[model samples]
Target: MRDGLSQEPSIEPQIELTRENLIREQDGDSKSIIVETNNSKTTKNSNLHNVIIHPRLKPAPFKIRDAYPTDLPKPTEICTVNDLKFYQNEELPVNRRGFKYKLCKPNPIFTSNYYSTTDIEPYEVSLSWFDRSTGSYLSQDCKALTSNQGWRSVRSNVGIREGIYYFEFKILKSDDYSHVRIGLGRREASIEAPVGFDGYGYGIRDVGGELVFISRRKNVLIEEGFKTGDVIGFEVHLPSLSQQKKEIEEFVNLKKSEIPDHHTTKKRKTNTKNKKFNNIEDNEKFNEFNNILRDQIPTKSKGVLYYDQFEYTKTKMMDHLLNPITVFGEKAIIEMDDKTKNIPIISNSKIVLYKNGVKQNETIENLYSFLPTNLEEIEEINLEPNLKQQSNPNYKNNDDNTLGYYPMLSTFQNGAVSLNAGPEFEYPPENTQIKPLSDRYNEHVIEEWYWDIIDEVEAQYLDSFD
Candidate 1:
């Protein structure tokens, strides 16, 4: 300090260091030590010691284990049954919509006022008349026969031939002005062939209840009854009234081989163009006037399933219409007299079959070919018809005089709403029996993905090191 400048006593006190940190730069000074951190606070105990073990380890056994992994494949098959054990967490499908004729407000309220059981009493009645042609019941003048009760029972002849006449009974209040509950009426028509000519014809409600039209001729015999009409009838038939609803979830497979594609050629004057818009071309101009729209249904390749002939049957009591009934009373019982007679056959047929289109032999032959080669063993027997038709009439109808009144044949209303019919009932049962794996829609690829994911997840494990 004296050589650089002038020597001087600074007004500052010098303090000596008592503690110092010596950081070694050489690697040889480094060493591992135990430190306490929040994460590794267990080492704070002085008793802590390092553990050394071999590389290999033995797995500890567990008393129980889970068989399935988190990566288990989802079930692709649908849950059809409500209580399916495989899918406890899922809900089964159901239809909540009820029948159209179900008791709903306003409709029922309206219907109940008309047939108020609490207020009105129902009645039962039958009608008969004399016929100059048949000599049975005298054919009464229909209008004259209908007691003035706001309705007519007039017997008037209609159709090309004259003999077809209807002795109609309609819904009407009694002349006594007594209101009645009109449910349904039964028809028991028993006609006898005249001595010389024939007596056979058909009847129906051409436009429903408005008019009960009979095809009075030698060739066509139609008979019809009604469950609903405006004029209250002379009487009504009452049976046990009940209602039931059924949910039909069915599977119907269409086989291409059975019902082959067919086409019929005929003359038609209808416009045969697609109406993409209202605009008409010269050829389609014919549609603008008469507006007759004609089109050919485009043919499509046959598929595995087809929607055909769908019918719904309900046993529910309809408020407006009465359930149909077949006669078992004396009105239908008949005894024919022995006399010379010329009979007439009545029909409403457009197509006639010599024999039914039953391939009975073909079905039998196919079943035989499917037998086992060695065939000493027996298989369970299945004796059921494979194909079906509407009604299978077992006998023919005869109108000859030799046929005295035939035991009252079964009678029916042409417009009676029937409960569902045909093979639709069997559909649900068939859909249930099919296995998922056997179906083409459920392919093998789905199963392959399931096992692959399951195995891969099961292969993963927790760290073996402790």
Candidate 2:
């Protein structure tokens, strides 16, 4: 016998049997046999008990219990405490490659390195500059300062030049919609104005939950600003060597632009006029006019000429440069002295702000270019004025390249804030994928994804069963 399709010999054996043989075969209980015959034949007995058949079965879907992850941390618990909680399990399950844990806990190594007590040292506020007599020193470390007057601020004793730093400010007391600022700044930042009121410093302030940049010349509104009880973290990254050089060059160029050349030209005109006039009376009149001009023009001290008359004295000019007028909008214009106007110096580096554990969005990133509602009105006010010119040597003494930034705090009347930088930091940052003050030029970090094959397998199995 042969198969009809393949035309090949059939594997089943030819059974030559009669009724007795059939009965014996059934009694023997052969499992599976294909009966074939070279000649025509028929079974003599019918026995169903001896025969068996097996069918293919599909596998059941994998069923995992809900209690698999018994140790996932709660977000509320993480928020209540000051210290950080870290988890070690970030990889996928060993048995199931398709499944993965999100590892929501903060990175332990990063958190430790960031809030390490070994790196940062303790510093106190300068009593000579801030209103120490009125506001109480809230912290035993002497880092925190507060005042109820319209505005009060203090500079940190330690200054930072290059390196990533993390610090925080906690609002202890303030009225509704109170102004709060946190940022890095130089000594030039006026003690009277908030931290970012001057171009030398950068700060983020709260105005109706909106973060605004407070600079000497401009007040730019950004995203949501922090309020009372909010722990605001600041990450200050100083400029690189190349960036510092570029900024220094820009400063030099600004210096050249600020000093006017008209004084020399006007003096030459007077000299030529005097040469033409031989009359004694005319000479006396010219001398009188020259004296008046000399008093009106700014005096040259060293090589730099002072332009802003309100900042006429050498000390006042230094104050104007260091302590900027902090008022925003048209108020700044109204407060400007009638005599002299000054422009702000924009820096190359920047800092980032964080609330709780999450990073602030990039929309409000740079505090240097922030502006309030009335931007155009603020820019029109001039900072330079014609004033009595005198020679002064202190104008050229500022060292642009070597200048470092110190942390500053300002308190409006009835507002108070506290500071923390390592050692005694009450609240450590929650998310620590990157170091503080590192990577200021990039966007926020995104989480990675793992394969989800379990869902597909379950769906396919259900469809087949149905």
Q: Give the TM-score of candidate 1.
A: 0.13
What tens-digit string does per-residue lDDT give for candidate 1 at 279-394?
Answer: 11322333222221111011111111110111111111110012122247645533232111111111221111010111111100000000001001111111111111112111
Off by over 4 Å in 1: 1-144, 147-154, 157-159, 162-170, 173-466
List model 2 lDDT by residue over 255-314, tens digit each: 445545542211112233224322323323443322211111112222212111111122
- Give the whole-model CA lDDT for all candidates, comma-separated: 0.17, 0.36
Model 2 CA deviation exceeding 4 Å by range? 1-138, 177-179, 198-200, 211-224, 250-348, 363-395, 400-402, 423-466
Q: Which one is best on TM-score?
A: 2
The number of the candidate with the highest lDDT is 2
Cα misplacement distance, residue 39 of candidate 2 (Å): 99
Q: What's each prediction's TM-score?
A: 0.13, 0.40
